[model samples]
Target chain A: MSARDRILGAIRESLGSTPRDTAAIAAEAAALLADPDAIRPELAGPSLTESFAAKAWGLGTTLDTVADMAEVPAAVSRYLAQYGLGPGLAMQQAPELTGLDWSALAPHDTVAPDEPVALGLARHGIAESGSLVIHSAPDNPILLGFLPLHHILVLERRRMLPHLEDYAALLGREDGIPRNAILITGPSGTTDIEGSYVRGAHGPGFLHVILVGDEE
Target chain B: MSAPAPQAGFKARAAAAIADPTLKIAIDRTTGTAERKRAAAVAAFSEFEAARARGKAIKDHVIAHLDHYLETFERNATAAGAKVHWAASDAEACAIVVRICREADAKLVTRSKSMLGEEIGLPHALADAGIERAETDLAEHIIQLAGERPSHIVWPAMHRTREQVAELFAEGHHPPPTAFDPATMVQSARHELRTKFLSADVGISGANFLVADTGATCTVTNEGNAELTTTPPRVHIVTAGIEKLVPSTAHAFALLRLLVRSATGGELTQYTTFHCGPKRPGDADGPEEMHIVLVDNGRSRMLKDEFREMLRCIRCGACMNHCVVYRQIGGHAYGGVYPGPMGAVLTPVLAGLERSRDLPSACTMNGRCAEVCPVQIPLPTLLRAWRGRSWRERLEPSGLRYGIGLWAAVARRPRLYRFASGAGVRLLRRLGKGGWISRLPLAGGWTGSRDFPKPAGRTFMELYRAEQSGKGGPS
Candidate 1:
């Protein structure tokens, strides 16, 4: 027998069922897939932007609020200046970012191995964990998130969701799930060396979020 | 050389751990920090207990109908262009991975930390097949450099000191740094691993949760090495246990909430990525081919018996962090891929009770493991179950069996037990000096570690009887 057959057979034997109820199994799977009865925490008081910023800040993520998309370049430039960095920023060719006038900054399409900065657009921001949801696409490359010393994420405040369940709900509405959807919470950090936390281990050392639109 | 054979028994291994001051300090510092962080994170969430309960329910539901969910996962994954392979044992799993790598013509392989991968000895398997593999997790990299197995599940190199890590890097890497600054060491590793990630033909990672709803394999990591390991290579392979399957993304998130908080005390890992399959036509970058290797190394058998609750483990490492015995001895003393309370129960189930007979007995039955377990696994109950099984099968040492048997026989008769206890106490008083027994027959295990406190002058029964009789105001 094939490994799959044998393994399933062993499971059947353990469950003590022969010719299990196919209808019940189908119904259960359908129920689980349709809508989740997930126990989500009550996150009501703070507005989505407030919760997102507070939670993100708590995770060591810096943020800047922009009233419109046009201000993103200035925000990025200012963040870079604060860190004593300049000019060359690797970014994806996403339409959301490409239309902006980045004449003052050198934006490269490809990230070098030791690139100092990269910018990506987030599909959604989860308020529960203060994470940015970035879907992989032709325009938004996945490497921009992991290959740079500093990562700047542009998130529309209106796209912020209250919980991870909401993000799942949003995906349920999509035509098809993206090949890769990463929920990045904070800058890369590790406590592996004698339990000391050092940021920027094999990923961006710093994560800056550009939250567009005024708070409700 | 091959790793030294496991110390004779849990006692011997634990004794050695107690003697190593450095190991003790390392274990204390690491577990203490993890415990504090977890407490703070869990406290911040008002609904943590409810969330934990939901996590348990979801896992239990999935495990009960595992065949259906796994089938769904395979179908959805295949639909999404991922090839799913089933392995009934570790060898088969390793063989499947090796075959895939060979077919891909992979030479250099980058790996993220996976306890399941360690259990299957994937690195050794790949090395024997002439495939070069580099561990990307900082702690795992250190362990790989030292040619040692991980001492802790989450913190693989928790047993290593800063100086030890610096020395290991100096020996392993070209042109090591001059100082032992942790931040510098991290940067050095990051610089070294970047080339490996960029140039590797294949990347291998382990999934923390596999979503059947979307056929996505998810990995959570703080260092983001998993993202690098999965993103850069042409082919990405996920080697995960079959038990990682969850019914939906919502369920995965519920467990993820508990996993990050319980493991490292973070609200969420730096990255919780869901890779549905290979890159799509419109995607700019990702693996062109993806493979999910579902390993069932002794887990199917675990599903059959009273010990099935062991499957509920999320690998949070909380059980070990709060365990008294594990806190003292560290993971190496457990002598298995997993360690601590979870290892004590799981190693026996996977490796057999005869080889791991001392593991269950090593616990103090403090129940802290169960209390802190995110999935609410009744760890103390499981440990006791293993102890009962060991006793029934006579897997325990002959001396222990004889000692327990003698005590059982004497305790069955109240008068004889009283007489024997009284006589023993008097004899102990005679032998004891300064109210401490320096040595005793058949108790070298106790005396070897520290002096045993002498018994009181009279047994509890004697004192109680005297008090009941109002004799001499009960001494």
Candidate 2:
């Protein structure tokens, strides 16, 4: 017998069942897919944006609040200046960030192999863990998030969810999950050497989130 | 295949670990920080208990109906252009991975940390097939350079000091530095592994959770090496145990809630990427082909046994961090890929009781492992179960058996027990010097470590009888 057949057979014999009802299995799986039960953690702040920023800051992610999308370049420039970095930034060709006035920041269309900064747009933000949800597509490439010294994520405050469960609910509404939907909490780090945490292990050393269009 | 015979038994290994002051200090510092951080992380979640309950329930439900979920995962994964392979044993799994790499004409392979990969000896298998593999995770890289197996599940190089790591880097890489700064060492490894990541033909990683609903494989990592290992190569291979299957993304998140907090005391890992499948037709980055190798090894048998709860482990490493015995001896003393409280119970199940019979006895039965276990695995109960099995099979030494038998016989009769205890105490008092017994026959094991306290002048029964008779008041 094939490995699959033998393995499944062993599992069946152990479970003491043979060929469960397909319809029943499908119904169970579908029901779970539709509305999965989860325990959502309550946040400290009154609004999702504040809660997200507070939690994100705790995780070592720098945060900047912008009143509108047009101010993103200025925010990015200010952040770059604060870090004593020059004005060259790599970014994806997403519609949300395409027409911005990035002249001040000298935004590049393609991310360099050793790009010091990269900007990307977040599809959603999770409040409980302060994670940015980025969906991989042609417009928003996945590498923009990982292959830079600094990662600047532009997110709309309205897209922030209360917890991971709410993000799952949002995915349920979509036709199909994307090829890659990453939930990144902070910059890369490791405690491998004698349990000392050092940031920027094969990913961005710093994470900066730009929250735009707040509730007020 | 059975695990290779340990270089030495648990007693000898643990003795050496205890003697090594450096190992003790490293283990103390690392596990101490891990425990403190885990406490704070769990406390941050007001619903930690509820989340743990739901996580356990989800895992139990999935394990009960695993066949259905695996089938669903295979179907959905295939639909998303990922090839799924099943392996009933370690050899088959390694062979499948080798075949895939060979077909892809892979020369340099980059790998993220995978305990299952270690269990199957994937690196050895690939080496036999003439493929060079680079371990990208910093801890794994250190161990690989040092030519060692992982001591701890989460912290593979917990046994190594920063000085040792600096030495290994100097020996293994070019332009070695003189200082032993962790930050500099990490930056050096990042630069070295970055070349491998860009040039590798295939990337291999392990999945923390496999979502059946979307055919996505999720990996949680603080270092983000798994992301690099998965994205840069033309082909990405995920070697996961069959038990890693969860019903939905929501269930995955529920378990993730406990996994990160319990493992490293982080709210979430730096990166929790869910790779649905291979890159879509216009995707700018991602592997063109993806493969999920579901390894059974000995898990299927475990699923049917009384020790099935062992399968619910999320590899959090909390049990070891809080375990008294594990805290003293470290992971190398266990003489297995996995160590600590979880290893004590699991190594026996996977490797068989005859070879690893001493593991279950290594625990102090403090029950701390169960308390901190995110999935609520009754670890002490499982350890005791193993001991019972070993006793029934007479796996213990005949000397021990006869000794216990004698004790049981004497304890069944109160008068004989009282007489024996009284006589033994009096004799010990004679032999003991300055209120401490420096040595004793048949107890050299206990006395070898420290001096044994002398027994009181009288047995409890003697004092009790005197008090009852209203004789000179008992002290």
Candidate 3:
């Protein structure tokens, strides 16, 4: 017998059940996804954006809250100049980011092995833990999130959710899940060496989120 | 012929660890910081207890219906272009991975830290198969270079001092680091690993959770090594246990919330990625092929018995962090891939009660592990259960059995208990001149290290009875 058959056989033997009812089990599993009953924490703060910003900053993520998406390129330019990093960026081809005319800084679509800076747009910002939810797509290559030394992500304030469960519920309702759905809470870090915190272990050493808001 | 004695030799190993002052300092500092951080994080989360309950409920449901969830996961993952393989044991799991690598013509493999990988002996398998591999996680890389097993689950090099890491880097790195600082060491590793990430044929990682509904394998990592390991290679393989299945993404996230909080005292890790399968047609950069190998490796046997609760572990390292005994002796003394209170209970079951009997005795039953456990595993109860099993099977030393037997005999009769206890107290007080006994028979374990405290002239029952009678004559 195949490993799968043997393994399933063992499980069935342990459970003391004959062959399981696949259709019934499938329906039950679907029901679980449709209406999740997992208890979520009651977030204390009134504003998700503020809570997100606070938590993000606590995770060592620097940010610039722009009045609108139109000002992102300039804000990103100023931030890059402040950090003394080069103007070159491996920016995602998403429409929201593509519409912005980044005249002051260089932008490309691919992330090189030693990409100094990469720009991607976060699909959602989790307020509970200060995380950015990014999904891989045609426009946004997954490497853009990992290869850069500095990853500058734009999370529109409207995309903010109260908790991780909210975003997960949204995912549950969606027809198609991305090949990769990632939640990045902070700049990559490790306390492996004598328990000392070192940022940028393998991923981006610095993560700066541009918290874009509605136009005034 | 009888098999070799089950190597549950925790006492001798713990003694060696205790003798090494440097190891003590490393373990104390690392676990102390983790404990403090976890305490503060748990305090900040108002619903931590509720979350723990929910986490336990989710795990309980999944484990009970593991076969159904696994089948569902297999179907959904296959739909997403992933080939799911089942392994009944470690060798089979390693063999499947090796076969996949060979089929892919893999030469260099970049691997993220996976405790399951360690358990299945992946490094040795890869080497034996002639596949060059690089460990990308900083701590895993250090331990990999040092040719040492991971001491802690989350923090692989939790027992290594800074100087020791520097020594390893100096010996292992192509051109040793000029500066031995943590940041510099991390950067050096980053630089060294970047080439492997770019050039590797296959990348392997462990799943933190397998979402049955979406067929996604999720990995939680602070260093992003898992991300790097999974994304850039031509082929990506997730080596996970069959028990990693959860019903839905929501359930996975709920557990992830508890896992991160209990684990480094963080709100979340730097990267928590969910990959369903191979890269889509238009995806610019992800492995073209993805494989999920679900290894049973004795977990099936665990599910069939009283030790089934061990499957609820998410490998968060919380139990080890809160264990007082683990804090003192460190992970290496456990003499298993897993260590601490969880390991004490689990090692005996996996390795067999006879082989790892000493593990259950290593705990003082402080109940801290259970208190901090996100899944509410009742770790102390499980440890006691193993101890009971050991006792029943006569797996423990003859001396302990006889001593416990004698004590039970005296305590069974109230009158004899009182007489024996009174006599024992009087003898102890007499021997404990100047308030301490330098030596005692059948207790060399206690007195060999430090002086045993002198017992009071009266037993606690006698003092309680006197106080209850309102005499209070002891004073």
Candidate 4:
């Protein structure tokens, strides 16, 4: 027998000497998967956006709120000016982003090895953990999230979920699991040296999120 | 040539570890901060206990039905374009990875921190296969450069001080760093590993948990190196233990909730990523191929034994952080891939009682490790079980066995027990000076490090009889 059969056989033997009901086991697995016995942590604060913002700030992420997507360019410019960053952005090729005119800012299609700033869109914002969920697509290269010194994510307030489980449930019910579904909670950090917290070890050192519009 | 055998056993290594001032300071500082942060983070969440219970329940269900779930996972993963391989031993696991790398014509590889990878000795195997691999996690990179194993599961180089790290960077980096600080050193590493990340032919990562429902492997990392490691490389190979399987994404998240809080005292790591398979059609950039290697390596045997509860471990390292013995001696003393309370129990089971007999006896049975365990694994009970097995199998020293046997003999007869105890107390009193014994016969292990308190000249039975006579309460 192959290693697979041997391992499975060993596991079956360990479980019991009696024969297993394969059909019953499969049904149980399907039932468990459909409704997982997962406990969702209660969201703090009065509203989802407040909770998300609180969590984001606690994890070393800077946040900006705009009235609408139209004002995103001005907000991006202001944030750059506040941090003394240039206008050149390695932006994702998403419709929401491409629809916005970028004449003032020089937006590139690819992320360079030492890209200073990159812009991407978040599919959902988790309030409990202050995390942004990103689903990879043809337009959304995974490198755009990793290669930049500063990551500016555009999250719509309407897409806010109360907990990570909420987003997970949505994914389970979705058409399929994306090639990469990442939940980014904060800027990359490490305490490897003397247990001291340092930001930007190998990914974005600074994560800036623009929460576009308020909850309807 | 094979590496030289360690001079002694766990006791000797622990003794040496306790005396190292650098390891002492590093462990003290790190464990103190980690304990405090974990307590606060756990307190911040109200559903932590519920989450932990749910997590354990899921693991129990999955492990009990592992054969079914493994088959299901294999089917789903295969459907999603992922090749799933099973290895009964560490060598088999490593060979599978090497074969994949060879098939991909891999010249260079980048790796994210995976204790399972260390367990399989992937680095040496890759070297033997003539593939150059880079350790991308900061602590892993430091230990890699220093030619050492990870001291702690979470903080791989917890035993190394900053000055030592700077020296490693000085020797490891091309143009040595001009300055030395956490940020500067991190930036220097980032600059160096970025090239390896972009150029490596394959990336090998360890799964934090594998969802059987979707056949997705989840990996959590604070540095985001795992993202780069898995994404940019042409072939992504996940080295995971079979025990990492969870029923679904929901179950994975529930366990993740407990894992991050207990591991780093954080709500979540910076990157909680789920990689299903290779890059899908029209995906701009991801690995062209993906493979999942499920390694057993003695875990299957553990399922039938009393140590089954140990499989619930999420590798949070919370047990070690809270363990009194672990904080003192640190991870290196355990002399295994895993360390601390979990290591003390697991090392003996995986490596066998003959090789790791001293590990089970290393614990004080304070039960703090069990209390802080998110999955509620009774670590002290497990350690005691190992001790029981060791004694029953005659794996312990004959001298210790004889001593226990003599005590048992005396205790079985109450009259002899009292007589022997009284004589022993009187002898100890006579030998002691200033109410303390600096050393005792046949107890060099105890007195070698610290002073032992002397017994009072009277036994408890004598004292009780004299008190009853003086009070006129008994004839």
Candidate 5:
């Protein structure tokens, strides 16, 4: 079962016995237990979203240039065309990516976000637990980042929230918002053997970054 | 002429580590909880960065003037009635320890988790001397019972699952328990070992941080087992890597903030112990004879090298827990007692490259370990540096060198780089179908289990060139 389904199932198990609305509890649990690997760095029409690299210092680096929608589309297409993200690619189109022209960079195969597409771009309003907040929806699937081999992501520079407060604020404004959210940062990596790192063990082998501007 | 004995070779032992699922689950849960706890602890400490910065600075200063601090520590510890011995090599260190053990006619020795003990192969050496060495840490005890070495630093038996424990516990005890209730197994082991702890002639421990100013050795343990080990023995022997010493208790206080949070994600270990020497004239309980054995054993060499920063480690195991590689494959896979990021940096230094050559080059250098390190050990940088040095020394595998050399050569030139990228994509496209490639050579391990997307027809540079030429992608 998918992490989303499992999380939903657990909440349903917990809330089914409750007197209050069960769906609300399930939605909340979905965000708490979202699949970590399904995050994506998407290249929609005008937003060039990429994955976050866990630099020694942090992911809070500021990229000031306000890029054009055309640049975003062009960047996405170029990565897809050269890197090849057609069949099993992910474009982790989250709520932050809702308004972009996703069809502009749509692959010929019409694959879902979880298919390991070219990239997935997600913006978490707050990331305290070494994760990125990605609110889910029909258009913004959470599975895109979790199951894929090479998960990429793009973060809006100004939208890099410190904690979880602003994340809730963003969710407060939306209705029936897919109730599921995810947090991703640096590709899933490990160092068990006296501290040697091996990439692509459980999650994406590669994670790329393309910071979008939110000030504009 | 033939394959070397498994006991004499580290690589052989490392291979054996992964085959045991019990060790693997213990490693997983241990490092998993440690990573989680560290994250939570850091979140709790609003002044964490300040604390880390101060701790790192204090330790670095102490290291810079180590000669002075060592002299001061020796003088003070000697005055406080603690005998100090400096051994430049493991043999010298081992000889000194064995001599002390023999003097006491020690039949049993209880030890806490000291990576130094593993490095010296002391337990085996003790066994050879007709002395029995018992590991006091819960995880260490489990690994000892199963006859295995530690894979993870914090939770020595982090790789083992609960069920495995039931089996191991059932093996030794006659009235063997019915099932492997984790708590029960722990309790039974505690009961079995409690007599040994009080009866042991000598107790040995590793210092988390040794304070020079107060001539005190501090150990942080959640179980407080190290304290028990030190207190009950007639002769207390403290073995530490040369790097464990800090200039003062004040310095220790600074490092403690990073140590607890980085190792196990607690505000503090359940117990924080500082031992100066044997029981004072009026003390209720303490060792009769105190010995602080300073083991330089590869540490003096590490200090002068490019990777000296690794010496700053406080054994927090943050690198192990948050480590992606350690999480899936576990620690024994690395083939050293250190395991995780610290192990990667340390194993090559202590064991030398020939036996542990694969360690440094194996890392992705994501810098997460360095980022979270309490003492600011530049783990990935050192790993990368070790890879570079290994080649200079001709210690690396020829195949890896050739492959990396070819990639490096191609990476230096744009035309060739693009050509290689294009060729790689073409080959991938030709062979990749149904979204997977089952038996691709050189990358078979990845493709055998999962799928590798055929590279897209474009390269990053090609698209950049197209955009520069005012030509959009071909429709």
Candidate 6:
């Protein structure tokens, strides 16, 4: 009779025996279709919220390349200064994050690992899905991805791959990042709770991005 | 040492697979999302075409010289204190793995996503051996929990919804309903598998690529499960096809760069760990021993066959993702662990066509699969080749054979064939509605979902003949 009725009829016909359980499944489907945030929240069960990828872009920032590394510490400093992550917060190293002056922001007393990163910045990024590709290597600390509540990433413009097929050109791609190159698109997110998404569940709560242009 | 065959057929299973509303929702949304992301991912590459060609060329080169690379890989892996085992068939592979599991007294095994394992039905063997093998990959674990094979390669449990997953988790072990939070699921899984990982006597992983130069193996995963799955275990084993090996790290990198973007629309996964050997000297947190089981398993046979180009496949599944047939029918319809365009060719070759005949004929030869294949495996051509094999093997249906034979007899003489076609068209047109053959004997399949454009009153040759001879006295 109606779209709902048709769907219900379809479900009834499909389920044969498992009618009620199928009803619950149908309702969940309707709810998921009805609103995504509801699903996101249910995914988190309204208990634990995880970060969305967009938030990760917001918390920490990015620059186009390592040449623009000079501007990154200042950007990271300003972002971190507001939050006071400077004096005591720990900094994890990424291979791409190497050559950046960490001392400028915080002189000493930094923790190495966090249950969730406060600030996580990726060393390499592929522009295709706005994915951040991180390889676990010595300089590129694996802790940066998992630890900290806030995360900031410095992505080189040159490193951004347009397609998944473009990685054939990377040096030592076979070896991969010696440590861990975490290709992160967004902040840590979880839709696992009840179907609703919660950001910053296990990883960074915030993701700030700084897209470094060629001239900038 | 095998589980009974899954009773349901492809269409039945696929229909059942999409029955879960949440799962359907999840599949539609996730696949839709992946498609969009893939579009964006491809858009960034100005040289996508060139990359495809180059990657295919590299893979082709490797497959061509596979024997050389395999030998190199063996020597290097042996040099690195890794023992290499070769299995000529799925049974042999399983036998080798079970023997290793037995020898090591490995009561428990944690495995990362190994489709090859699914192909060989490894879990049943492990079950028969009474060795617990836990699927470590989150998606694989979900399928493992369901006691079902993976429907999609890249996202193995691509068809499951959180609620369905919750229900699965609710089964057997219930602390509460399954959490939908991807993170919680991760944690729940981590919580559940934490003990498994810690206590696992052995770890088994499938390599994304095997580096011959360094005797290294790589497994890529989004979660850190792969790392824990291998490092914490006492004995770590890697299983893969011989073609998985490349000459050097450079070649492996070449494959890796394309793997994530092509499969997951990411530049790379979070964890792409390389398991070289057991805890080497000072390596505190790693496996005590490492062994690589190189499974030939019908591959070398294919190497000398016409379908040898299929060996270059890196299992990236772009062809699967892009195939319209696959998108409509879904993966399970291929009736194998491997599905889509690649599966159509591979299923028959690897498993024998008598059991896998439906695969080759299942396709419409749309050519989209070949367009998307990273290694440029001419999937349709390979499907045709398989069709030929089936024909030669007398697997073709009698009706189809008779019809084709009749058509061929008529086609031998162009005049009779044209007359027959033209006369048939005219007769059909006479009975047709509004110039289109909306229905016909055995032709309803063509008109079921789409319209068949009306043929002209006369054939092109007839028109040409009249025009050339001026028989109609046209101005």
Cα lDDT listed for each candidate: 0.89, 0.88, 0.87, 0.89, 0.62, 0.63
Can you write out model 4's per-residue Cα lDDT over A1-216, one digit (the tens) per residue?
999989988998898866678787666655554433335566766899998989999999999999899888887888788889999999999989999978788888989999999999999999988999998889999999999999999999999998776887799466578989999999999999988999999999999999999667
Off by over 4 Å in 2: A18-38, B1-5, B430-436, B467-475
Tens-place lDDT per residue, model 3, A58-146, is 99999898888999999889878998988899999999888988888889887899999999999999988889999888888888989
Rank order by TM-score, top first? 1, 4, 2, 3, 6, 5
Can you write out model 5's per-residue Cα lDDT over A1-216, one digit (the tens) per residue? 632233223333422333544355334423422332222112111321222222201422212133543355555555566666663344544444435656665532223323454355555523332345444434543334433555555656666653333343354355522222333434443332222233332334345545566443
lDDT of 3 by residue, B287-326 (tens): 8999999999888878887778889998889999888888
Candidate ranking under DockQ, highest first, comes to: 4, 1, 3, 2, 6, 5
* lDDT, residue A87, model 6: 44
Docking class of 3: medium
Worst-scoring 10-residue span by lDDT in model 3 chain A: A29-38
Across B23-56, the per-residue lDDT of candidate 1 in tens digits comes to: 8898998999999999998887778887787778
Task: Candidate 6: list runs displaced more than 4 Å.
Answer: A1-216, B1-30, B161-163, B169-173, B177-192, B426-440, B443-475
**TM-scores of chain A, one for each prediction:** 0.91, 0.90, 0.89, 0.91, 0.51, 0.56
Residue A13 lDDT (model 3) = 80
- What stretches of model 1 exceed 4 Å from their correct place? A18-38, B1-3, B7-9, B433-435, B471-475
**Clashes found in each candidate (C-alpha, N, C closer than 3 A):** 0, 0, 0, 0, 65, 93
The better candidate by DockQ, 2 or 6, is: 2
lDDT of residue A166 for candidate 2: 84
In model 3, residue pairs whose N, Cα or C atoms come closer than 3 Å (at least 3 residues apart or on different chains), thus clashing, are none
Worst 10 residues of 2 chain B by lDDT: B1-10
TM for every model, in the order presented, reads 0.96, 0.95, 0.94, 0.96, 0.65, 0.71
* Tens-digit lDDT string for candidate 4 (B204-278): 999999888799999999999999999999999999999999877877887888999999899899999999989
- Which lDDT value does model 6 have at A155? 56
lDDT of 1 by residue, A1-216 (tens): 999999998987887785657578657644543433334555534678777878898889999989999999999999989999989999889888989999999898998888999998988998877899998888878888998999999999899899898898788487679888899999999999989999999899899999999887
Residues B1-475, model 2: lDDT tens digits:
1122377788888887787888888888789999999999888787888778777777787888888999999999999999999999989999999999999999999999999999888999999999999999999999888878888899989878888889899988766754569988998888888889889999999999999988999998998899889998999999999999998888888888899899999878999989988999888889999999999988888888878888899999999999999988888889877899899988886688998999999888889999999999999999999999999999999998999999999999999999999999999898799979989987887787668999999999998988878965545
* RMSD vs true structure, all candidates: 2.5, 2.9, 3.4, 2.4, 25.3, 15.3
TM-score, structure 6 vs. true: 0.71
**Residue A118 lDDT in model 4?**
94
True contacts kept of each: 0.80, 0.75, 0.80, 0.86, 0.00, 0.03
